[model samples]
Target chain A: MPKLSYLKALHRALRDEMDRDESVFVLGEDMNFALTNTTSGFLDRFGADRVLEMPLSEQGFTNFATGAALAGRRPVVEFQIPFLLLLVFEQITNQANKFLLMSGGQRSVPVTYLMPAGGHRPGWGAQHSDQPYSLFAHMGVKTVLPATPTDAYGLLTTAIRDDDPVVVIGPLACLGVREDVDHADLVPVPLGKGRIHRAGTDVTLVATGHLVHEAIAVADDLAGDISVEVFDPRTVYPFDWDLLAESVGRTGRLVVADDTNRFSGLGAEVLATAAEELPLRVPPKRVSRPDGAVVGAAPELDAVLQPTREQIADAVRSVLKESGWGA
Target chain B: MSVLDEVPATEADSAVPDSAALYRTIRFIRRFEERAVELVKAGEIRSGIHPCIGQEAVAAGAVATLDADDVVLSSHRGHGHLLAKGCDPARLMAELAGRATGIDRGRGGSFHPSDFSANVFNATGTVGHGAAIAAGIGWAAATAGSPRVVLSFFGDGAVSQGALLEGFNLAALWRLPVVYVCENNGYATTLPAGAAIAGTVVGRGEAFGIPSSSVDGQDAETVYAAVREAVVRARSGGGPSLLEMRTYRYHGHHTFELKTRLRYREQSEVDSWLGRDPLLIQAARVAEDERARVDAEVEARLDEVVRFAVASPYPDPATATDHLHADGLRPRPGSAR
Candidate 1:
């Protein structure tokens, strides 16, 4: 079996889709040079026509992708930074997303907005570090944040093939993560399906994107004293609530580790949903950044703002204590 | 190809700009808008429309230059644009009436209707965003080796929007087959164009290296001649051209103005624009008998349009979410739990 890195998985997905469908092409800044590495070797393999280099006009090119999609072409647009997503938010949400409904289903905008370096990078400051996947999910856009290399490969492929516009956020923290996999086993991961990384009876730790790795580590660290189930909801918008319910039902305990801000974040939603529907023996806990958090210049300050494995372990312990198991 | 080569000498091609046809189009738009206004007053149409009564010639002339296969991205005030592009007036009227038989199944209403079957891709409520979308469509068509040119229509207000200018840059850089038509109606709602836009409308296109020009938007013949040249340039891979049509709106921005009586422009200014009415200008070019026939024909057609709109049923509330997603995935029912 070959080792596949998360970034390489993204590259493989783009290469494979372009080979499979002639209509699939990429347009973004520095695509020719593959500045993001997800588009690495794409220019040579797919030619300049398909791997287009765009000027620094995010709004212009964003809507351009929508127009191309309307004309029966699948365009994968790569954004270098997370804030660019905010810049073109209206172009994607108001223009691209609204077209299908506004046209009365006469057309579909099959454009993929790929954020290769989404979420925090050490000293990248406030603008560069944002996990805004929850924003898209709230807006009803199909949003995916794959936690593993294989899941990255699968979700990116699925986003391209999907008829409606989708936003695929490739967490910067997960880009270096690698896994052993057979190339033949790489397949499309359906949106809205949750993957239980590890099954346990004590507590269910629901995670997203790079946070799944943190949850798995916490689960391993607490293995002697507690059993933990790691549930990864690969797609955030069409969430696998059924699977989540089943997991929480068995464990009767829930803790969510999300990278986004605490207020109205994915973690909050998971806790709310589980509390409302699932049978929880203990009160749910959430490990997430504080309200309106911005990772500052200092490494120490930035370290505390992001959800850490220690925080997840603490949240688990708190839930256990609340259920009188740790007494 | 030279400008002369752009206009085919074939009789069918020449007849497209025939005097009577232009008159009928302008007359139809004029009467249709008047009838729609009456419907608005009668409460048949819920929202008051942004009538393009004075600027009918711009749409009629520019759309006539396009082939049936060509696509158009229109603005909020797009009823005339759709009619000129060959949309069924009855269906459009029904759309205004929020009827199930409307072009958008009554989902889009007056502000955001789209008639894909007529190649009128969409009418965006966002002022200048359509320009970027149009450029994308043009790029797609060019990449596919199709000669189809895309026309993006906006008002003078859109000239100042940064996104629209960004679109101009891309269109010029890629030589995308697009014609950006800016109808300078001298007002952006209550604000005058001079107060809102700096430099000039065509200057924005010129700064982007697009071949920009000004045309008489009041005359259908002049507008046709100017837009025909731009369409030719685009089809022959000359990239995009920006044409600033100096026109005006005879009515208020929306029908609500009929009650509010906002005084932005003087009544004299309104009278002056009305003097250059597109319907009257095109009517003069046709014979008196022909004009009368077109008038009577348009009157009868509008009667049928209104009748159809009034008789059409409203869409069932259960189907309100029908076209929300292409995958037909309805939203999950609310959970009390």
Candidate 2:
């Protein structure tokens, strides 16, 4: 078994895909030096044509990738975040995403938007931090946020292969995650599937992105005292609702830990869906940022704004308390 | 080997359609637009379309330079573009009528439609965005060593859009084989081009280091000649070129204007443009009898087109969410799975 880091998994998946498919090419800003390290050695291996270094014009390049995809090529665009994905929000959401439906299925825009620096950056100002995966999902653009190294590699591979516009958000929080795995087992993970890290009889805890690892830790910390099931919906858009239904069915208690804002965020969607469909014994609790939150520059303020493990644990306990179940 | 030597400019003109063929296209576009407008009046096309009545030459001329393999990205006022690019008139009419037999499954009624079958890749509803989209297609073709030139058609209004200029930059930088034809219809919806765009239309391209020029958009041959040279340059690996065609739309910006009577453009200005009508200019080249024959043929075909469009079935409401994904992934409904 070999240890693979999350960043490496992303890099490996990109290199492998480009190697496998001649039509697949990388387009984005600052790829010559691989400033993001996602396409570290791509310029040499893939050549300038395949690993293109686009100008700083994000909107122009985003739509350009759409055109490339429309012309029968799969363009994996690297959007340097802080606001790269946000800048081309229309290009992806309005233009690229709608190409297939608007074309009446005559064409497909398989342009994968990879945001390596998505989610909150510690002590960074609002400018350098924002998670727009929910935005893409809301716009019906296929969005994925892999929580670990293996999931990162597998999900990214699948995203490239998908014949629709997909936004792969590699959140900074989960970038440091590493796991020991057999190389052969690193395979494509299907979109709209969930990986339940730990199963518990008491409550189903749904988490996404970096919050998944945080959720698993809290579930472990509360092991003997409380039973908690940590479920990671790898592909956020075509969510693994069936799996969530099964988990919540057994526990009858639910808690969601999402890194985005509480108002109209991923957490809100999960809570809403659970309320509508799930057979819940207790009122579900969700750990998420306040309405329209921006992680402040100060480290402490940033830490406080984030959904910590304590909040997840407290949310689980609160749901149990509401049901009159022993904590 | 130089790609220029391989595909010379002189050799490109050998494929340019004869004068009779050009007149037929202009006449066909004029008739198609008039018929489409009638369908709009009949309420077959729920949302009234942006009628490209007066500006037929721009589409006819620019598209004629393109080979069957070349692709085009069109704007909102793009029925003429689709027709000139060889889209089946029946299917296009069906598309406008919101029928299942339409080119886009009736999903793209008027604003956004892409007929890959006709090499018309897309018609973006968002103004000016088609420029960058076309640039992308050109980049892909050049990268693959394919000699396919991409033609992007936009209104003078698009010249002011930052995204459009950004598209110009990429096309110029990569020298990606693309022909950017700006149909300067002198108005962006209602606002005069003079008021909407600062500097000039061709200047926008020149600022981007693109080989930019202006042509008489009303004359099919002039439009053809200018775009033909640019197309040859593109096929020979010469970067993108921007040709601002001086043209106009006779009807209101859209059918909505028909009832509203926006009164934006002066009647005198309208009368002036109507004087140099593209149909008359192209018809002059062909004999009167031949022109009359084309006119009759066009009317007969349009009659069948309208009939076929009316006969075609509208898509089932249940499949409204279909084609959202190319793989046909049925999204779980908003309610629940």
Candidate 3:
């Protein structure tokens, strides 16, 4: 067994995939020095041509990756900041995402948009802090937010292999987490699947990205009082509804913990869908950042803006406390 | 299909008098825009088109030099490029009408029409993004030992975009078989090229060491001569060439501008360019009887095209996710139960 840090898992996946398929190569800014740490040792392992360092042109490089993909090469683009994704949104959503459909099934853009440090990083200020995986999912781009080291490795490998444009949001909180695993067990996981971290009967807590670990801790803390089922959706856009339905069917209640803004966030979609179709005994609840939240530089302000573990526990308990069934 | 067999060190002159082909291309483009404008006025097309009214010669001349296997990537104002690439007018019209018989099966409307079978990829609404896609196609073609060239068309406004310049760097560095044709049509929507652009459009490509030049885009004959040379250079392993076709738009940037009442280009300037119209320039070269025959043939073809487009059906809503992926997998419906 080897200790695999979340970042290491990402490095392993990139190295393995590039080794397995010669078409796999990386392009990004400051990638020569491994700025985001995901591309650490990449330049050394794969020469400069395979590990390309680009200029400060987000829109340009994003489309360049699209072109490279069209050239029969699989490109993995690394974005240092989350907001850079916002700058090149049109390139991804309009150009890369629309090619296959617009070409009437004549072309495919197999490009991966990897955001290494996604979500709020305290003291990084307003412009830097954002968790926008939900935006990609909403635009119908393949979005994956893995919860653990193994899932991160598996999902990233799968994203690079996918025929369409895919976005992988690696949350900041999950970067430090580590797990013991067999190196041989490292494999590509299928997209659009969910794994139940912990199964219980009282309430089904749907958590994503870094919040999945928080949810597992909360479930353990209240293990004696309430039965909590913690579910992590590895892929958000083409979400595994069958697995979610099965989890909620046993619990009869739902709670979602997300790191995105409250308005039209993934959390809202989750709770809305669950309430409408699932036979929940009580009203579903979601804990997320305040509407249009901008994570500030101050530690206290950032903490207050983010969804907390206590908030998740309270939301779960509240959903459990509700007495009435569907009106 | 592989038309350019040898690379010429200097610009190549057309062996055949290319006025007829150039005129037919420009005429098809002009008529296509006119019909699309009618559809836009009727509200049948939701996204108002960025009509390439006066900038037809650039597309006609550049695309005329390309082979059937060559790729053409275009910008938002791309009806001219489509027509020059020999895209069927009826299917293009149907795409504007949101009918399933369209090249994109009605998925792409005005800003994003694509026909990959003809090697005409989508003309992205995003400015300057098509350069990279075209470069990619060129790189792929060259790697596979195919002498296939890619012609990417953009406006003078795209020169300011960093992405377009980045594409220049990549194409020049790799010696990719690509030709970047910048149609300097004076205005990008309301802003004049002088106001939006800082330096010369040809200078941007020259900065990247790509063989760059400026040509009279208004004259179909001149444009055809310049593009033929570039195509010969690309096919002969000479790498990329950039041509800045100095032209002007006769109409507003988009048809919607006709409603907004903006004074961007003067009536006199537009009239001066229209006087040297590619349609008349090439038509004058042909005999009077041949010109009449070409006109009658064009009119009959357009009528049939309109009939086909109007009769085509709208795509079914159930297959909304079709062609999103090359693997042909539709995304699972948003989970409710």
Candidate 4:
């Protein structure tokens, strides 16, 4: 078994997909130098034609990808900052996303919007720091947030292969997470499925992106006192509700850890669904950022605003206490 | 290629007929807007339209030279462009009235009327996004080796958008068949071009090495001639062309402007633009009897269109998400299951 890092997985997926499909090409600003490292051997492996370096025009290049996708090419666009996705949000949602439906199913836009370093990158502050996966999910765009290296590789491959527009948010915090797997098993993981990293019966902790790893750690820390089921939903939009239902059915208590803001965030959606339909023995708890909190430049101000490991543990403990189900 | 290598510019072909066509387009657009306005007031149309009253020639001339197979990607202010592309006037009226038999099954009211079968893609409510989609359609057509082209129509405000420029670059780079037509109708809502834009629209296209030009958008013939050449260039593998047709919006930027009363432009400027009315110019080109015949036919067609649209049933609420996905996969309802 070989160990693969998250960034390497993305690079491998791009290289492999380009080689597999001639129509698959990589484009974005500073891609030639592999600025994001997601297209790291791309320029050399596939040549500059396939690995295009665009100017600092995020909106322009975003549509350029749409144009390329329309030409029967699968374009994988890498954005260095999470906020860049916001700048080109209209291009993706209005143009690429609606092309198929507006054309009455006459066309398909298979463009991959890969935010390699999504979410708050410490002192990166207001403009650059953002985790906007929920925005895409709300717009009915297929959105994925892979937690680990294998999942990153798998999801990116699946996104490229999908016939619709997909947004893959690779959290800056999770990019270094490595996993050991057989090279042959580096296969495409189907979207809308959940991977139960740690199965438990006391509480179901649904985590997304880098929060999955954090949940895994919290579950381990509370291993002796509580049995926690940490589930990683690879694709957030076409969420694996069936899997969540089954997990929560056995546990009867749920807690969600998400990276977005508290109001109308992914965590809120999960909590709402749990309360509405799920048979929860206790009120579910969610660990997320404060309402409409734009992360500031100061490290301490940022640290207070973002969801922390302690907060995840507290949310888990609260859910467990509400159910009175700790082992 | 030299400017001479292309179609030679002449007063007969370049200025007069061009101006005449511009007037015709403007006239058609003006009359269409007036008729639509009357319908809105009469409650025949539910959602108020963003009239293209002042920017008629842009639609008339640009679409005048397009083949029936050529595609058009329009904007929110797209009714004139759609009409100019030979869309059924009645069905268009029916569409504004939210009729089932309308172009978009009445799902896309006024702002998003689409006739894909006729290659008229609807105006995406998102500003400046159509260019990329147009580029995509062009790329598809070019790769298929089809002699067809795509005309992406947008306003001056859209030119500031990066996506439109991206569309320009891709079309120019791959020589994908497309014509980027910008109808500089003075203002994007209340935001004037002078206040928002940093450089000229034509200069942006020229930077991409796309053959860029400026035309009198108020004249239909000018629009038609420029578009015709661009269409020829695209069909002949000469790639994309960017034409900035300078014009003014005769009416409010949108119907909402009626309430805001944003007086960004002078009344004199509006009066001056009205002097070059597109419909009157085009009507002058034809005999009195011919003009009357066309008018009577258009009026009659609009009547039936209104009737059909009004009588059509609203889509069943149960199937509201019917066309959301082509696979017809209803998103799994939120449940533990």
TM-score of each: 0.97, 0.97, 0.89, 0.85
Q: Which stretches of candidate 1 lie over 4 Å from their true place?
A: A324-327, B1-12, B333-337
lDDT of 2 by residue, A1-327 (tens): 889999999999999999999999998888899998999989889899899898889999999999999888999999877577888898999989888888888888999999987888888868778888888888888999999999999999999999999999999988888999798989999999999999999999999999999889989999998899999999999899999999999999999999888899988999899889999888888998888887679888787888888989899888877844333
lDDT of 4 by residue, A193-223 (tens): 9899999999999998899989999999999
Note the DockQ of each predicted structure.
Answer: 0.77, 0.84, 0.51, 0.29
CAPRI quality level assigned to candidate 1 from its DockQ score: medium
lDDT per residue (tens digit) for residues A1-327 in model 3: 889999999988988999999888898999989988898888889898689888787777788788778767898999999999999898898789888887667678999999988998988889999999888888889999997999999999999999989999999889999999998888899999999999899999999999999999999999999999999998997888889999999999999998899999999989878877788889889999998998778888888899999999999988877996754
Ranking by lDDT: 1, 2, 3, 4
lDDT of 1 by residue, A1-327 (tens): 899999999999999999999999999998878998888888878888899899999999998898889889999999999989999999888888888887777898999999988998898788888889989887888899998999999999999999989999999999999999999989999988989999999999998889999999999999989899999999997899999999988999999999899999999889888777889887889999899898897778898899999999999888887844333
Clashes of 1: 0
Q: How do the residues B1-337 of candidate 2 rate in per-residue lDDT, one tens digit apiece? A: 1101112234336545457777887888888888888899999998789999999888887877778789988999999889877788899999999999999999888888778977999998878998889889998888788989999999888888899989999999989898999999888888898888778888898988899998999998889889999999999998999999999999998999989999888899999999999988988889999888878878878889999999999999999899888777877776655
* Residue clash pairs of candidate 3: none
Per-residue accuracy of model 3 over B221-329 as CA lDDT, tens digit each:
7888888888889999999999999888777887778699798678888889889776777777767886676667666677777778778898899888888876665
lDDT of 2 at A137: 80
TM-score of chain A of each: 0.98, 0.97, 0.98, 0.97
TM-score, structure 4 vs. true:
0.85
List candidate 3 segments past 4 Å from native: A325-327, B1-17, B34-48, B138-146, B160-162, B169-176, B206-210, B232-239, B256-264, B287-293, B325-337
The lDDT of model 3 is 0.84
Name the best candidate (by lDDT).
1
True interface contacts reproduced, per candidate = 0.73, 0.92, 0.72, 0.34
Error of 4 at A30 (Å): 1.6
- Report the poorest 10 consecutive residues by lDDT, candidate 1 chain B: B1-10
